[model samples]
Target: MKHYDYILVGAGLYSAVIAWHAKQAGKSCLVLERRSHIGGNIYCEEIEGINVHKYGAHIFHTSDRKVWDFVNSFVEFNRYTNSPVANYKGEIYNMPFNMNTFSRMWGISTPQEAKAIIDKQKSEITGEPKNLEEQAIALVGRDIYEKLVKGYTEKQWGRDCSELPSFIIKRLPVRFTYDNNYFNDLYQGIPIGGYNKLIDALFEGADIKTGVDFLAEKEKWMSMADKVVYTGAIDEYFEYCFGKLEYRTVRFETEVLDTDNYQGVAVVNYTDRETPYTRVIEHKHFEFGTQPKTVISKEYSTDWKEGMEPYYPVNNEKNQMLYQKYREKAQQQEKVFFGGRLGEYKYYDMDKVIASAMNGWEALHR
Candidate 1:
């Protein structure tokens, strides 16, 4: 049996960050991952010299300067602004409903013209929105709602906009500026090297055991470590005593083309109900690299079932209640501290996952 000061139950950014801190604090650590490789959800594989995100697209965007600086230590990042395109029945439009999208929709260029168009559209809706469709029309008006938001949102949730809650759509940001930058974060980019390489470097000195099931040897593993940092699904950690929480999942269909370029953009979102898939991603665009061939993947959102990979937590009231019950159970385990997206049942981006691990390490002292 192996032993260590701390046993990290994942090899993702969260576990890597925690292991880094544990090593800095003079604590021996062991990281266990069920997958053959590290980097968890952010793991990327090379195909035709292009690094394709094995999961879905993971763009690094964060407003936290500390999180940015922390990630920069392990790997240098490249300047790649996210400018996703939306396809509505073969009619492509710039994403984020920016000035360009506004002009295309209304044949107007100035901010005032765009506002007047939106105002005229909003003036027709007099009643309170009862569902997502109504709410989207109330915010961005009918034309933009029909073309851009409706189909995509429905595809993502696997439900019609009319059936979904109004709280889901809430407000659609219609920017008056010409900026196509998807997120308004201060820092946004991709790693110079693939995420897999960065994770390997971060775990160079740490004892990591991939393809090991922590649950199978739970008692033995727990006894081997001085403390436990669990990063698996919270309900599974507790054997689903309170019942499993619902989640939304995504399936990816990848294809390698012999051509130099598959699509010009990194991500092209299909915002029409006619298309079964939600988006198609060209991996090379993320790194701005030119190769002999290209790799592409079509993403489809689906309902999560047993023995399938769970992506997003169903943050509805029912799941929230179930998570709260699991959280209470977790708090009672004095020696085990839960962290990361799966462990906490929260949706976390790349930077936030790293920051969470750092914070988890600090809290161990108190």
Candidate 2:
């Protein structure tokens, strides 16, 4: 039975940022997390002197200088670029379909040669692209599309590329340069210690209650706070009166290997139907650290269900319509504020989430 000026529903990055801002303004706050720990999906655990991303692979990338300065205030970020490699069967290719990948796929050294091959491949199509398959083929040509894009996109959405929308594969930019960096962001790195440390630092002076289901005792917490910042699913917050918005969930199979440096790179995506898992991530490679053993996880994207943890919001037309309804309802609620991925039903990287929190705080203050 604690009282505070504000109540945060989730201890994820969004809630942490809001609590940080609220505390900065001299307002008392309390954070209640359903899980035993903080950091939400971005939480990291240390294994063999390395930080393992417990939920999945999360890389911090942003172009906003304000966000970079704000996050750096809490913890130092190392120079880690996301240069993920793709493994189609036994062959390895550089990610983002860069020059290295082009060389590996077509034995082409110059950009002109690669462009010529792609033009020829694109000419084979008779008309405008209709679906994900045609769109990817038009953008990157046939060979790269089949070997890299096709199976991966199919696995991610649990549907054939031809059945999916063309917008889904509008353009996966293929850089002609030798750069293997996946993201085109101004700042990209991971916290030196771990994301867990960053979360702890953000909530330094705030009151936190873990392993507490605020929904079960909603009335009590509501009475304690003047305002509520909810980071959980918007539909769930209102008890799904308009039916559930669809989501594509991810399942991870993690194992600790006996040897060090399993899978030379940090992340290797399996973009073929033969492979059940989408990608394999060796956590230590992110920091290029040395250890006697390693831990790895194979990710599988599945259809969303009620009880499962929703990973990616399925943004098809149906879900969008449903989200619009929820948004209308959210606008009518005076005391509650909804932000973050689940609350907004939008896909967001870590930095985008931080910038969003900052924006929300600024609006609240104004």
The 0-to-1 C-alpha lDDT of every candidate, in the order given, reads: 0.89, 0.89
| lDDT per residue as tens, model 1, 1-366 | 767989999888888888888778788899999988888888999888888899989999999999898878888999999999998898889988999998887788899998888888877778888888888888988899889998999999999999998886656778999989999999999999778877777776789888999999999899999899999999999999999998899999999989888768999999999899999999999999789888999999999998787899988888999999999999999999999999999999887887888788888888
Per-residue lDDT, model 2, residue 37, is 90
Q: State the lDDT of candidate 2 residue by residue for 82-149, as single tens digits.
A: 99999999999999888999999988899999888988987777688888888888887899889999
In model 2, the runs with Cα more than 4 Å from the true position are none
lDDT of 1 at 55: 93
Local lDDT at 10 for model 2: 94
- Superposed Cα deviation of residue 55, candidate 2 (Å): 1.2
Model 2 local distance difference test score: 0.89
